[model samples]
Target chain A: MMEERKTKDFPRSDSASGSSDQVVRTIGLSKSFGEVRAVADLDLSIPRGCVYGLIGPNGSGKTSTIRILNGLIRANAGRAWLLGEEVPVHVNICRIGYMPQEMAIYAELTVLENLELFAGMYSLNKESLAQRADALLDMIDLTERSDSLVSTLSGGMKHRVSLACALVHDPELVFLDEPTVGVDPELRMGFWDHFSDLKRAGKTIVLTTHYMDEAVRCDRVGMMRLGRMIAEDTPRGLMESTGETHLEDVFLHKAREGSA
Target chain B: MNLVRAYAIALKTLRSLKHDRRTAGFLVLMPLFMIAIFGYTFGGDIKDVDVVVVDLDAGSANGSVAALIREDLAGRDVLRIGTSEDRDEGMNAVKDGEAWAAIIFAPEFTVRVEEAIEASRTGSSAAPATVEVHIDASNPNIAQAVVAELQTAVQAVLVGYYGANPAITVSEDRIYGEDAEFIDFFAPGVMGLAAMMITFMLSIISFVRERSTGTLDRLLATPATEGEIVGGYALAFGLVALVQSAVILAAAMLLFQVSIAGNALLVLLTIFLLGIGSQGLGFLLSSIAKNEFQAVQFTPLILFPSILLAGVFWPLEAVPDLLRPVSDFIPLTYAVDACRSVMIRGWDAGEIWPQLVVLAGFAAGTLLLSAYSLKKRG
Candidate 1:
């Protein structure tokens, strides 16, 4: 579906061999939970190296969209393409790391062990997994607590470990669903800094968060409501279009107007 | 091809097990406890079976059979001997639950025995010693024991007086079990029960935990297919079942003198397959249970049917014919039958192929069902 939606520049073989032009593409993606349309007839074309924010309210299909994109559940009527390949049931899901709303790290394992396990799940070599684990522990400022069990870690620490796990294999694209829930402000800033650093390294990121302020850092934001994208533009472009001073008020206005 | 990933998943599982000490204990110690409890308790011989004897013979010379009976019953602590002058008292003793059986000897038993011995030399059909034992027919084991004790006492007295060749020959044959102690036969069923308990309960609780903790959703988001996840668990628990079966078999052999007449390897293989079947069953059950407590509550539903109808404790043949068909439906019945035949009868794979086929069928069917359950859209 992403292949079909490539109206923009497609990275040539000479420019970026084996590298994708579009990291994620979805065409007319529709997912229904019973009679409720969780994600209906949506199309998205995400570039290979931009931080895309999917901002939506509770039960606004942000989770459902991420779940579908991650291949956790099949779409009732749609197709998805990841790095130019169709998202079949047996797609290369390992290539795209996903951090869910619920902290996905195993609490029973030590932080290091959790990193090793996640890295290994991506089929990382032993030495590479160890090195990556150490680097991630250092990057997340969790090296001192590497040996501590995850269950003993505070919520913010656990969230950091979860993010580290998603990045363990150094995937080109990452999907983070409500990654900032229960996190303190300082840790949340540190997390956003890491996300920006990841994007600077040419890794595509698609994250969902209800916190509208955090969304200002994303290259672009798609405000979704009731399974439909009501507004899609850069935060500055949206602010300019709506003449709204705050992104939160823009979302509130759109929500009030029953537009998004 | 992602062997590393699968191994990582397994390692994570083991790591989690370290934190959940109760589940770890259940996985490792529960089998040992089952073996210890069942191995020790069931291996004990049937004891304290109340018996009331109504001996009507009146003379010392003729009462030698009674003396022989009292002598033969000397060391068997199971037989609680009670005497009655009248047959009604002994019969009443059995009816009133005071005794398991009532042994009624006729007034002319000794006299008739002697006469029959004399007449048997002339090739008469009359019995030399007709000891009529009216047992409480409620428990077949007690009835069997009562008849067997009477036959043994008669044969012993006859052998003491006239050697193996008595004046009149008595032929003994079993009605239900040809020649089996309860322990000898029940061991295989115990194996199935042990496997079922270890595999089913643990997986049910573990999977429920996975669902509740949202680990399953996370895992599902990864490249791991539901089949692979379930398959990975099957491998882990399969190994557990193997070790458990070996321990139980060794214990059975050591403590109960249980002979495994079949190949121990084949028996283990059967148990492993049964383990997979049970794991699938656990998964299928896990979908219905919302929590670990509910999972435990549902465990006995599976346990009761297998215990009562699976021929684990008793032969299906011993069950009423009307209820016998239900035994055939229980998966453990086949395992118990196969295990017992192999362990006790020294049956080969060829002899036990039907059981293997059935177990394979169960594992395959349950596994498919379990896989389908994971793919449930609703």
Candidate 2:
């Protein structure tokens, strides 16, 4: 469905949104909590059919930026756009998917029940819900344990269930916060393969993670520190510009340069 | 505002309870246990109160005034009358807490009553008879019961002598509750209170869980609006309040034999309104809390005032003059009033519309406030 829209020559969006190709865009986006600034004047853009990785330490503003764009919280002093509409737009929120850092699924419900719940919120009728849920469950490899209560599942399995729930609606733009935090190496590879599949299908993914090694797999990596994007480019460009062979060394060099 | 969205949220909440046996048990049985405790403490007749009677009547043996009154007391089920020759011994029994009260007849009590009756007939002054009652008022309930029993006996004995006292006669014509008990008064109040506590506590805690667990943020990112979420919670908790009411009413009627004079469904309707309003209030207050621990703190803040001032534990009349105005503002006061009017006084909805209107106002107002609070920005 998303591939069809990408192939079609749609008209340019309003001037505020640069073009229909930028699935996610932000300008001077800032947010604060009391005296601490979470996201300070951060400018970012993620194009269609691209896997974007937002790499930052614990106190950096990766999650805050995603929250503002998702309309979960409004930006303090900036504007954003998602899917060619000015953000915090109530009407167009269904086209985006969000998987928060916390285990947000209901612990008392079954794995299948969690996916169906998010599907219902998007107003998917019964027939579509069953079809979408079955496919998602198969992808997540929880088809057999769909009826088991989530509270009884293993930690890695629970994370997989959260991901399945996020993708049940097949959102055109997806935001995943630390999506592979607790997964085993084998499952992580399986998840990366799924993301590659989604990108080929013309879906945009914006994910935040501290795993420096994973940034190599993303099409573009945004190096963030103190609510500011220090460096953003293709992995090879970042490695070459910073004279660092490893992606982890590239981040350390950029972070130290920004601090100095 | 959308029915499908609202119903969907309600279904998810109810479905979560199906596997959680402990929480479900707390939801249904907590109110039942509380009602049992309150009913046991407040309802019932004071039975088998020991009383000593010292009769010193020096006139008429068979048709004596003292014997008539004593026989009247002994026949009733409330008291067990024991004979005593010395008034001091009877007084000592009451003082020692062995007996609830002492009934003493003064010497020549029958002669004095008869003389008093003649004096009244002839329009002359005559000495009054003294039927002295010495009671231990330690337990006020037992004391009141003993006094009421004695008054009935004395009145029955005196009725023949004076023939109903034509000039000072005032008959009580009850328009309602010809056979009301203390349980009858308490059942409706308990139902309202149980409903309020359950609905109020559940919504606050449940909402806080949603926020702390990050589920609320996930939902907010979707197509679901804050109003739809709040409406869904109201639907679910409102249904819970209804089920709690049914269980309470059934228990009250089956165990305590509390009969409803008017419609039972109207009584449930009143509690439902009150419960929905409380649920909204809970949701509104939940904004200040950061977690379930803080959310639990609000229960006492809301429960104590409603229980004390809402006429659940006692009537509004018993409330202090200063606090009566405060009582007027509590939604539970109107609920208890409406429930009592329906269960005991046989009042229909038309007669209790004012209370219903007040409750409905609470429901609408608090729900609006909750939805507004949920939306930091529209």
Candidate 3:
């Protein structure tokens, strides 16, 4: 089934030219903290301009893998690449946007100021930063609260502001870690729509979520368990191959088979 | 390494402070309040100790020694004199805490003094005429002041009665602080302490919050380098420390009339270096603390040692010989010493270059270590 899906969608060229089609590629990527292996002997090939979801339960190492890819943390062994450049290097950071699972925006700063800070770190020009901030504020539907302090905003509003900050730099590749965990249902739908829009604009997104329903929205999903990927396939392909109608059932079948 | 990115971090810090009114208030007002409390309340000379006297000596043909002692003590404002008819009453006054000391004169006080004088003139050793002083020794400063004042009174009476003794004479010529009061010596120390404490605390808590809240990870994920983040915080906190020092110095000068004998610019420069050092220290400490609560636990670790050993309250000479060397390792010691030498002794860069060098070394070392720690990934 995996071979059939790969041939149907990816169709490898049997040559080095295949790497250009992928934005992120990892080989035997592993990390350990004390006795716990957060990620172990993992390999991934995520195509460019696709919405990829890493689905897992809590403590399943999704965030650790993303952190290793973003160079926030070092892998214990093996190598990962972003934009064809080895990571844990600084050259490709400017080309990526990262939103951590925690509410990472500065609460003491106003919304506009937070956006401005991230923009400045990316070294965006004044005119371009101003336009980018305005457009992101509109997209996040936070244009009115732009002048309000982040500490004064409600939890949902702060989550949206955090998303706006990640997008402010307009990077080609973005990593959003549970971006819709606490978001309201309406805003969660709005966020998925925005993700689709981002993908249509030729940008790659790598997100981590535990919501099975949300996994179906991704172009491809990697189900993780016990620090290893149990399965990777399209939403329809996973459901059809497992003889299950729901993504959660497919994940359960994959997890059981992985343990067996 | 990029100055523009470092400046962006600094600008963001300033913007955050503008919105965090509570911390901003603490940053500016805490130093001012410290200056006021130290300068006004704890900065006075010990004076006007209460003492009681009982005179039992009868008048003699030569002179009354009790009357001479009384006259000498009355001339000096160091003591407030009260009288009692019985020696027991005077001693009771000291024991009851009503008076710091009690002076009791013997019945043959005048005759004994005259006889001693006669024997001294004949080049013979004589029994000394003594004044019995019962003192409360609980407070060492008050006890010493009482003893010194009484000795001065005795010397004055002997000089008047026996003429000036040519055997030995002592003169005082001070190199610094000739007429300076305690507050003048204290203001500079407070400036250094305030700069160190405020800058260190602000940076520690700020960085800890950034780390625990995951903003540090987000920033790290950006193009900003570790050095840029550390440099940015150092620049911002350095400015805040300078402002705090200036406010404290201005308040000290205008309110307490504390003197600044040297170039005011040098004093500020010393404080600025101290601020940078403290900021670097804050960053280094932040790497150890996992949360704001843990960060705050470090306050006493910094406060007690600095206050006791940094010559903030007392000079290094007053600290025990064994503990004195500990002050040399604390960064605040050099800052306080440099500021005092600059503001009180009017010392220039040439005179204080060693202190400035140590402070610069501390700032550079801590900042480099802090930046390296930030770059380390777990």
Candidate 4:
């Protein structure tokens, strides 16, 4: 159910047809909360278009990394680049859609109103805002409950609405934080398919989750533990290197080795 | 700046309040309820105090001073006459808090008066009349009130009996508040109190809730800067404060007949400024509170200072001169002073600019501090 497409023919970036660019790049990026190192000095470079899964256990600094990338929190040292511009200085936040793990959509607002608010934050004009909001609602298959208060929706339905809010502005890069946690198998597969469609449209997608089974759907996966990225490879490559049959056991093998 | 964004946020908040009928009703009726409760309960007039009389003059041979005292006390309703045979009984009554004060007429009171008059015929000036008053001084307000009432009553009686030919007299003429009732004196104070309560309590709790719910973090993650978020909320609550002030002012005018001498719009402006200052203070305080309960615990820290030093309950002049400077820092001091001057003294914005400037300065300072506090490392 996690694998929405059997073709393994994910769309390659048009830039690979002949363009010069790395979508996101960070050098010596570090963040610390006083004495505790949340994200140690690290270097990362992600190409323009890929579904990147960051899999980690709780308190592994996965969320902290995403927050720093989102510019919600500052790093202690080094620099980050989003698209071509440096992070924090030239990154236009409206160009990025971030769905937090906390489901920060207003509970008192209707599903449609939540989307409208996010739309406003992006400075989308009213005429286009309604059209975009409707398209998002229909795409998320929440048109039937669009008028309902988010507080009244089921957890899975609320998650769908949260995703809709993140896409209301049609951002270039999307951050989905545990987007499929409470979703059942069928719905989770549907979300992955939507993300696959977004990746096809040349949007960079980054997600964090603890489910090792879902990591196979990503074009690339980074296994992190204890404020460090333990492994960064394709699912098959990680399994082959660990001599494990399942991605879950491969994660366990890497966690034990500490530097895989 | 960014008035459009501020308007959007304000309209969104107002719509939320509309949907939440309970909070909407609270905003409309809470100030009125506070005003009614405080005005009716703590605003009673200090009048018709009960006093005991020990008359040893035997009702006098002629129309004596003792008779005149009873008649004047009865007329002004200043004293409810209670006669006791022994002075000890009346004094005990006062000590035991039975009566507010006691008037004692000595045994030779009429004899001395007649002899003093006879001696005055030999071209000698007579001494002023003396009456012994035994009072319970534990409550200085009541004690001093009784003394002033007795002095007025005695002067009135002497004037009436002596045909207004007194050698000395004291007269007072009230300029403003000639017929000011308790409600009149309290209406402006109630306005300030309402602004303080709504701005401080609701803003703090609501901001703290946003923090706990993670919505604030999410908001900060957006393109909305710290200034935009705080500014948006200030705009919303500022409009709310205006509507609340208008409601309270109309109610005071209609129900209590509270008159306004200055421009009513200026009163609203004062309340709006007060609300801004108080809301900024609330936001600053919410940064210190980790939760709603902790937020509520800090309310008394603001409330006690405002209540005692802002001259809401009494005149600022009544406060000791040494402690008068402290009232200058209490933001509500400006609110109460400006509102009272507008309603009672018929002062306009020109006359009340000093208070307005102080409140404006307070609002600016607190708002900057509140915004900075939000940026601190947690």
Candidate 5:
């Protein structure tokens, strides 16, 4: 389904061959900033149409991986491919959407204007942009206040606008770095439901989260520690292997296993 | 580079300014107010200095030599003549700061002048009448003006009244700026300074804010190259500086009656080049600044030096020889020198190409360095 959408929506160079593989892949990906190793010999493989969550503590390199994959930064040593196009492919930015951890939208611009700007970057026509902006506004539950400046909105409301802006152009792959950090529980539920909708539409989502409950909802979870992914599996697979009932306990079990 | 994409970024920046009216007002009005306030307050020649005159000269029937000098002083607008009975009183007025200067004519004024004139005809030495000047020297420029005014009045009285051609006469010829006022010289420097402030500070502060707010991160996620980003903001800021310089120049010429010896368009072109170069320097400087506060701290570091060393308020000729090398290295110096030459000295582009070339080279080099910095960050 992700392959179908990759051809239908993005039309990548290799999509003509109809290659169905991991939408994101990394081999021996390592990035260091001075003395701190942000990502060390890290490996990542995310299939199309899968809602993959990276669960890690602070300084565990979840954001670094997303930044590296988005071509916003370079890895010290690594190879990464996105949609069969090697990483740092500037032209393929249109095929992927990145929602950074910060409130990256312009505070002075209205919520609708923010979505329109990102959509315009992808060359979405005015008519389609209006339609998608409306739908995304509805999904974010900000339809009525779409004309309000992002600065006037509360912290949670700005988070919602950030999510809407990320999905505005309907990119085939999405990288969301802690989208629901400051969001209220009710809105967080709405966000998870929207992710499910995106997955059903053959869109791949790779996100980082601190919520164990949200991690349980991912199709697969990669538990990272000290810039290394100690465990990668479905929530049930990790639970069954560690004999742990809670995702948090399963992460603890993996952390213990890796340290030992 | 895709200019259309770069233009989109520029439009977004402009729209941000349009939405925030207060910031937009500051950006446009700050330079205008700076130029106008400085222009109106420090615009022109000094006038109406108070001077006490004590006349003790004994007239010898021909005329009172002291009276003739006093009348000449009273006729001029530069000095306000006040009478004093004694020389001590006149000196006291200057000492107490109530008057700028005191001019005292001694008791032998008319006799000494006649003897001096007779002695000059016979080619014999005799002392002429002396006018003692007691001046408040706290302000040297004011003191100089008072002395200069007195020289003109006394010289005229001596030549016209006494008919004594004792020595050499000096004549003057001006090749440029025949009727230039102090405002004419100052307006060009203000324009260059305005351009530098508006483009450089805004670019640096705005870039730092964007980086901290994650807008640069968002921009990098797009296909826009580093050069496109720099070029986009440069275009917007360059146009802004052009408008600002034009407004300042027009107001200066219309209100202050400052005239340009050369083309007005050339002045703006000079400002635009300096402005874009300043924007590029802003970008390069932003790399060292971690946030908007830190970015703001860089302003005085750059502005104070430029204002002082760039020959903005004073002529380069007035700058000490030790600082001339520093002045030559500042980009604003070139812009100011170019604008002044065009406006005051009436130099053409052909004559001013060295300055223009330096300005162009600065803009190109800083802009390329900025683009390289952005590319490196990504």
Candidate 6:
């Protein structure tokens, strides 16, 4: 079954392929913690240079899917690919950046130090790292607080630091889990602007959030419920198809249909 | 493994510690504090015990037994002799805790001692001269010191009286650790214990924090392998342990005058290896703990057993025979043995290779296990 999925997913590596534009592809990707299936038989494909928001409530297997894609955890069944390379493989790890929902930045370290540490992990040279760190700090509007320890930062500032650390290596693919959960509306607008800039610069972004407003900004959104994708469409398309005015109503409509 | 990546992890960890002033203070000052507490208070020798003596023996025509005891014990400073009017008074002193022990010499002590010596020559049994020792026994060390001092003084007097007869005299020879004291034996073990404890505790708490705070998940997503992560931690903690050991050894030497007879570098190397092994053990143990509070629960589990079985405060020979084999399995045991051999016996690498090899094996095995544990993510 694994071989079948592998061959079906990748046929002739050098040839122009159906998945050529897709940065992330997964089929029948399943994961379980104890008896509860956090993610079950998830089939997802994310195209390059597109912002794909995984919209779901809490406990909807969004974090699990991201973790599996980033090789932090393994799928119980099926396989995944990142940047045309098989995930759970070490070769393309440097090409991918992940920002976890929790505050993953080292609390004891300053914001600049956290950025430098992540940049160094990717073997970035001193000149490039310093330049990139400054740009990222400015982008996050945290240039003044870069020298302060992350623990002293407010929750939203620390979230910005985590996002900056994820992007410090300038990876082609970035996975952000709930990047704007506690962010202020103004900062969330800034994050969306920065993400749009990243998308325009040809970086593929996959993010998970429950906010309908954030979901509306994505090029496409996958609405997840109970370890499965109930619907996948553009924000306007989803509202239109469900005959609803808002993404929240559309999500409720799809969830009712799924349970039915 | 990528050396640069591993070094990056090490640098990040060190940077984090730089900001964590409390942990940094613990790392630098804890060893000094431990040395001061253990070296000056808990590890000092029992000395200058007071003993009340009611020497009722008047004389034996040649000398007085009480005078001889006073002469031997008074000058040596091992025992402080206090005179009592009678056995009741001497016993009262011991009972009142004024003295550690009371030596009540029989009135016929000298006569009976001489008679016993003469009777031994004639191959006949005689009544033995008795010295009844009434001890407080509250502090066993002081009580034991009193008894040991009395025996030594008595033996010296009898041996002098007999003029070193070949038939019943014991000769002395010098070997390793000539005139070694308790502090000398204790210092090296303290070094090993300090290194093991600090390295283990820091790695465990640090790793647990990494996991709980999601830094480990972020790191795992990077290009860094689990081996590189563990290696990075081991390197940083090993260096810290080296510094800690140095502080402890210097303090032990300067404050307690603990001697180091062998290559000091070799002793330090053993301690460093123990640190590496302990860090690996910490990593392995951290995998079982979900949070820092659970990690703290592991302290006494690792500490008390190592202290009791690793021969830190005492020799392995002093442990019960049934429990002797258990000591060999503890990593700190090999460290303590190697360190003590180097610092006390002046043993070089050739004589201490087995211990070094075992320690190396322990480090390698635990490090591999730690890496495996880290890689075994759900």
lDDT per residue (tens digit) for residues A163-247 in model 3: 8889888888999999989788888999999999899999999999999998899999999887899999999999999999999
Collision count of model 2: 0
Please give, for residues A1-260, the per-residue lDDT of candidate 2 as tens digits: 01112222333447546555887777677888778898887777789889999998988998888877877776777667788787776666788889999989999899989988999899999999999999988888999999999999999889889998889888888999989887788888988998998899899999999988988999999988889999999999999998999889998999889889
RMSD of each: 13.6, 14.5, 14.8, 15.0, 15.3, 14.2
Clashing pairs for model 6 are: none
For candidate 1, the lDDT comes to 0.76
**How would you encode candidate 6's per-residue C-alpha lDDT over B4-86 as one tens digit per residue?**
99999999999988876656765776567556433533343445567788889876888875578668878786677888878
Model 1: which residue pairs collide? B260-B343, B261-B343, B261-B346, B262-B342
Task: Write the number of the candidate with greater lDDT, choosing between 1 and 5.
Answer: 5
Return the top candidate by DockQ.
Answer: 3
Instruction: State residue B256's C-alpha deviation in candidate 3, in Å.
Output: 1.4
- TM-score per candidate, chains pooled: 0.72, 0.74, 0.74, 0.72, 0.73, 0.75
Candidate with better lDDT, 3 vs 5 = 3
Off by over 4 Å in 4: A1-20, A89-91, B1-169, B318-326, B376-378
What overall lDDT, based on C-alpha atoms, would model 4 receive against the true structure?
0.74
Say which prediction, candidate 1 or candidate 2, comes out ahead on TM-score. 2
Give the distance in Å from residue B136's predicted Cα in candidate 4 to where it truly belongs.
30
Write one digit per residue (lDDT tens) for candidate 6, span A55-93. 999999999999898888878887777877777857778
Candidate 5 regions exceeding 4 Å error are A1-18, B1-166
Q: Write the per-residue lDDT of candidate 4 for residues B257-305, one digit (tens) a residue.
A: 9888778899889999888888888898887777786687667667765
Two-chain complex of model 1, DockQ on C-alpha atoms against the true structure:
0.32
- Residues A1-260 of candidate 5: C-alpha lDDT, one tens digit per residue: 01111212233445421255678877678888899999888777889999999998988999999998888888877677888777786656788988999989999899988988788777899899989988888888899999999999999899989888888888899999998887899888888999999999999999999888878999999999899999999989989999999999998888988999
Counted clashes in each candidate structure: 4, 0, 0, 0, 0, 0
The numbered model that scores best in TM-score is: 6
Candidate No. with top lDDT? 3
Indicate the TM-score of model 6. 0.75
Q: How close is candidate 1 to the true structure, as a TM-score?
A: 0.72
Error at B299, model 5, angstroms: 1.3
Local distance difference test values of all predictions, in order? 0.76, 0.80, 0.82, 0.74, 0.81, 0.81
lDDT of 4 by residue, A79-196 (tens): 6667656666234578788888887888999999888888877789998998997788888888889899999998888889889888888877787888888789999999998998
